[model samples]
Target: MRFPCPDLDPPYYAVIFTSRRTPGDGGYDAMGERMEALAREQPGYLGIESVRAADGHGITVSYWRDLESIRAWRQHEEHRAAQARGRADWYEAYEVRVCRVEREHGFDRQRA
Candidate 1:
């Protein structure tokens, strides 16, 4: 099970991936897990939060230390393979946005 990511400091970068799945699991679960694990190992990776609805809509936001780190993740060999598979199999439609976070504030009951 996935939980909300811990609040991170501001001035970081966030890559938001919004997607609509094609249909069925189609091995998406395994690939998605692998990608998340690989991302955690990359330099400058901070955290990630993801969720999907029963209707196959989903969003995943990955936090990074800087633009360079984001770019490196985009070009990662394994990530590229996953992207290709996503285009060919997993996602029916998707959009990506990269933004610099200038401020952040949140409350977590567990943390408090």
Candidate 2:
């Protein structure tokens, strides 16, 4: 998706998901879109950014209002199912990192 969500305001949480795909799409693209849509419907979901390289490595960092929000999203039934499918069908390997964003700053020349 986009590189990053704008003006996240700090004191939030980010779930960083890094992975390597197995091979082909194998329905992963559709499910990924579905999960993203579902995440947007969650109570504390801020936004999500994702990208992939030609070598099959990818990263998706999802912003949330708090740890509780992140936990809820993780245990969401559909999201849990997607995680299962990712392990069984889509991803060769993956890692998830959760961090508190205490502060943030950036530049956007395009906005200037």
List per-prediction Cα lDDT, in the order shown. Answer: 0.93, 0.93
Candidate 2: lDDT over CA atoms? 0.93
Model 2 residue 12 CA deviation in Å: 0.3
Candidate 1 regions exceeding 4 Å error are: none
**Candidate 2: stretches off by over 4 Å:** none
Quote model 2's TM-score: 0.97
How far is 49's C-alpha from truth in model 1 (Å)?
Answer: 0.2
By lDDT, who's the top model here?
2
Q: Which residue pairs in candidate 2 have backbone atoms (N, alpha carbon, C) closer than 3 angstroms, thus clashing?
A: none
Instruction: Give the alpha carbon lDDT tens digit for every residue of 23-96 in model 1.
Output: 88889999999999999999999999998999999999999999999999999999999999999999999999
